[model samples]
Target: MHGLIGQLRTTPGGRGEVVAALVEGARDMPGNLVYLVAEDAEDPTSIWVTEVWETEAAHRASLDLPSVRAAIARARPHLTGMGTRVVTRPVASLGA
Candidate 1:
């Protein structure tokens, strides 16, 4: 499985808007096993997104989806910077 973990930094007080856009776009995605968005406990303007997909290609294809594109457009204005990012090969899952 393909997995991605990343941190997104938003403009002041813009985290909620970014999170909303991401969650809305993630509602229906083929090959998506997990799409988790979480607020950073230590930073008000930081958000973390963790994604799991059946394959690396599946994850790449999602970028072209209309919803995904729209979400990117919506969130772009609020994004200030990108933080830590990691790509991983998932070997197992528990509840997913």
Candidate 2:
């Protein structure tokens, strides 16, 4: 499986909006095993997203989806900075 972990820092008071868009975009996505959005405990404006997919291609294809495009557009303004983006090969997960 293909997986990704992204860390984002949103504008002041914008994390909620960003998280909302990310979740909405991923709703009912095919090949998506996990899509988790979490807030940073130490930083109020920071958010983290963890995604697992059946294949790298499926994850890439998700970028072209209409819902994803819309969500990206919606969240763009609130995105102030990005921290880390790491790719991984997922072997297994309890809930995924």
Best by lDDT: 1
Tens digit of per-residue lDDT, candidate 2, span 28-95: 77888999999999999899999999999999999999999999999999999899999999887884
TM-score: model 2 vs. ground truth = 0.95
Worst 10 residues of 2 by lDDT: 87-96
Residue by residue across 1-96, what tens digits does model 1's lDDT show?
999999999999899999999999998889999999999999999999999999999999999999999999999999999999999888888884
Q: Evaluate all candidate structures by whole-model CA lDDT and list the values in order.
A: 0.96, 0.92
List residue ranges in candidate 1 displaced over 4 A: none
Give the clashing residue pairs of candidate 1, or none. none
Clashes of each: 0, 0
In TM-score terms, candidate 1 sits at: 0.96
